[model samples]
Target: MMIKNTAIIDIGSNSIKTFVIDQEEKYSKIVGFDKSMSNGFDGNKINNFDTFVDSIKNSINKAQKQSSSKVKNIILITPTSKNKNHLISEVIELNGAQIEDNHLRQLNKSMIIKYKTKLTHCFKSHYVIDNKIITDSPIGINCGSLSLNAIATIISDEEIKLFKNIFSKIGLNLIFIYDSSIIYYLYLKSLNLHKKNIVFIDIGSSTTKILTIKDEKISLLKTLPIGSMNITNDLMTLNISKDFAEKIKTKNIDLILNDHSSVEIPVWEELGKNQKQTKSYEFIQSIVTARVDEIFKLVLSSIPKSKFFYSYLVTGGGSMQLNLIPYVKSKFGIELELVEPKQVKGIPTFWNNPSIMLPFCLNSLIENGYIDKFNLFKKNDSFSNKIWYKRFVDLL
Candidate 1:
């Protein structure tokens, strides 16, 4: 069987990652993978646009070298900065004509034009025709009027322009740009794990995102400025390097203290001189625990008052710290489970790392035909048969 290939570029605040996957009917393998650290933010916004574009180009070039096919288009997963989700409804008068695809397109187009925000993804929750709710497509049905209820995930137009400019420089077309939170929600729903309300927390290097899933759909999304890096910075108060602080954060030391116990860690004083520093496990735990508490508090404040019927799920590189599960449970009173890529089949073990889970989830979604059927990308209406449309005809 011939395998189809897809490439994904995930741009985050802390790193840029590129991955190429080749898949048959039911299985897929990661043929290429590359990553580069993002330059820390300049003030409140991302550093230089040109510098970030260059980093992305370098990662994509490395991935292309490992793949057998050239990557001309990519699925871009963007950060949640300046992104918002809104539930909108619009009524269309059919004038006693049958509803058609064109009418549905017009409705969506009107919403976009009215809001003036660049759409990242839009999901049609349901349609009401003549006061009757319809879950499926309402096309070919005779009706005087119809209403569309949709959830529009959007970001600033400036951000969209920035990504388009970056991809243009690299000779790649942006196939789809999805908010990172939406990607996680889709991935979780694909696993059939949303029979009940689910609270998802993704702790990235620079920011943490919280998503609320109700009735198997995303109801709310909030991003906190604090993340795992804050804990690393907090450890810097001990006069340790960032790298060393990161190591301490991920170390498999017990955070739960029945009694006061101290652990001595070696610190580099000079080329050959090292000093053993005694630090109580409670002290180290206090630093990390404080940050985690603040993150959950913000998340709780954002979500509506409701009971969660399912386990809280947590993912991302920051959430991989040892004993994080217990820390969250003790502070938040909710047991949290770390999401493992092993739950997703047909992918290599190397692709299971938390650092690249976003790309991995995207590959799985594409392989299962979810993205194309859902119209996740912006549609091109021009008559010209561009190379992108020719290559991804099914998607268009």
Candidate 2:
């Protein structure tokens, strides 16, 4: 048997995580994992590009060393802080009853031209036929010319340039660049959630991404900028130190603090509760609960009500909150489940906890050949036509 190693690096607003796995036909436990927090690129321009690149490179380098495997191919999931919107287009065309590569190419060409976008990856796009849903690549089957419907998750060109520059600095070729939400969809597929109408939620430090899968294909997606970090900020503003605020935020106390408390906050704490309890456990919970509720509301409004399904499958560092799961369930009237990324095949079982290892599962899915990439654009005519190329060479 041959041993293959695949590495996936997810760069997000909160932290940068790397997952390295040994790949066979079926992925096994994770072999290597690395995570670095406090990159601090949220809600502001990333000024230290060099430091950021070094941070990304160091994560992969550390994972490779710990996992003791050589990487063959790298799948990159880029940051989605700039914008999140749905770009939908419907095309009705007829090319006889037989569909082949030419038809696909022609349709892809026209789409790229009209949208002014380019294809960089290959992913599944489904269409509604008759009353049932069908995938586009149903070749050698009987059908009309075709009515194609597509919903694309697009990241701006400015973001792509940032990604290219980061990868270029590390001297690694970017085989594919996909939104983190797509990577999450690939992760969901590994868990058998892809076949059903599932809402997969990735609650990170700075943003929460909601991706909807209906009829086994991506149907809708929405992202919220608020995340677990907001809870910390809430505590910090109450004049509590970072260390103590984090502790109080997670600790469960019998005392119930209301939304409107007159607790005065101090810069630091004296180990135990003082007379002036500026930040009470109840207060923190209220703030967290309210913000999380607002986040979910925003997500709910963006997607169709029918797509909510039974519940939301949640993951990411924020999922660790014990109160969050129950709160979300009762408030939204939806079942909530946390994704254990380590349990997935291809990811090493050494670190199976979701508190900090959610990205590892995403990495494993990409390595195990479960994730699909969408090509945003086709190669333009200038690249294929020799005459245009020759003219450009002469000018150079």
Candidate 3:
């Protein structure tokens, strides 16, 4: 028997990554992985198309080499950071027809068609069969009609088309295209966190999203233009390189400690001699504090207070900053929990990094049988074509 290879490519403002898994792997464990620095993108447009294309190709090539398998099809994750809350429902009058998976699939499709949204991440799902209330699923039941109520997250169609063009250039077919925020939400939901007035905040390199789940219904409160990169940009005003600024921001700066008044940084002096430049630790802490404060002010003023409160959770590349949780707790008067997926046993250790949590947890969700509910093979455009692609379908 031949092994079937599947891949997931994640494109974000920070990096382009490739993760591989095959039928031979146990529990959908990631068999191979590689990444390269991303050039940049603004919505549907790539900043440097040629350079970006090369990065994508190189990342995939390296991952394939590591896994020693040619990828049959790919699941692409694009960081849209686009979140619009839309409540939509679709009803199917079966006329005494038995409900099957196809009916459930059609109802989801109908909601997308009528709602005019390209992507819908149903945070809350329900099925009403005939006159009976069913929250789980209506499959295998003979019912007169069924309806699906979904509180979905919507993204623009152009962003998806942008990825399709990239796929064609890379000579790969996509199994599914998902917004990074939705993937984060799915991974968060899979963990089954404490549910009373929870706020799911995903702070990326360039953007931040706040999704409030109150009483089982999720709402997209805001997507702010501010992010961790902005803090790094602010640090650059101290006459330091951006790379050094970001490095210290993530690993060195400690907001919880006030023991130090100034920290010395090594600098090159007059060709060969090395000199130290002293920076005030208080000033460094002030820059980060001000940036986070700005984000809080914008969030509070823009959204309804009724939707924001209690149980705060933070994740993403930005949340990896040291001592952030304690700082947030002390300043905001709300406890901040750093959300991380429990490590899967019997996998390589690098799978546990919080920086790659987006893809790692997504892979876990697939392992836990969440993707089965999506009917991805039945409806995705990338899997719809080609006879050879069917071989990989059984692996799903």
Per-candidate TM vs. native?
Answer: 0.76, 0.71, 0.78
Q: Model 1: per-residue lDDT, tens digit, 1-396?
A: 223445688877667777876777766776777776665342137668777777788888887788887777776787647777777678899878999899888877776566433445665555778766454479888898888766677666666666666787888777567767766766775676525578888888878888887655567777778888888889878867677887777773445642547756667555756777889888887887777778778777777764345458888888877777887677667788887665443334654667677777777777676555444233431112363344335332
What overall lDDT goes with each candidate model? 0.69, 0.60, 0.66
Q: Which regions in candidate 3 have their CA more than 4 angstroms from the true location?
A: 1-3, 24-26, 40-44, 82-85, 91-124, 127-134, 137-147, 151-157, 194-196, 268-273, 306-309, 344-351, 374-377, 380-396
lDDT of 2 by residue, 9-88 (tens): 77766567777766566545556677765263663357577777778888888778876666644566666654454544
The clash tally of candidate 3 reads 0
Q: Each candidate: how many clashes? A: 0, 19, 0
Name the candidate, 2 or 3, with the larger TM-score value. Answer: 3
**What's the distance in Å from true for residue 206, model 1?**
1.9
Summing lDDT over every window of 10 consecutive residues in candidate 1, give the lowest-scoring window: 376-385
Sequence-dependent TM-score of model 3: 0.78
**Residue 185 of candidate 1: its Cα lDDT?**
66
Tens digits of per-residue lDDT, candidate 3, 199-274, equal 7776777777786765444555568887788888898777676778888788778867867888676663457556
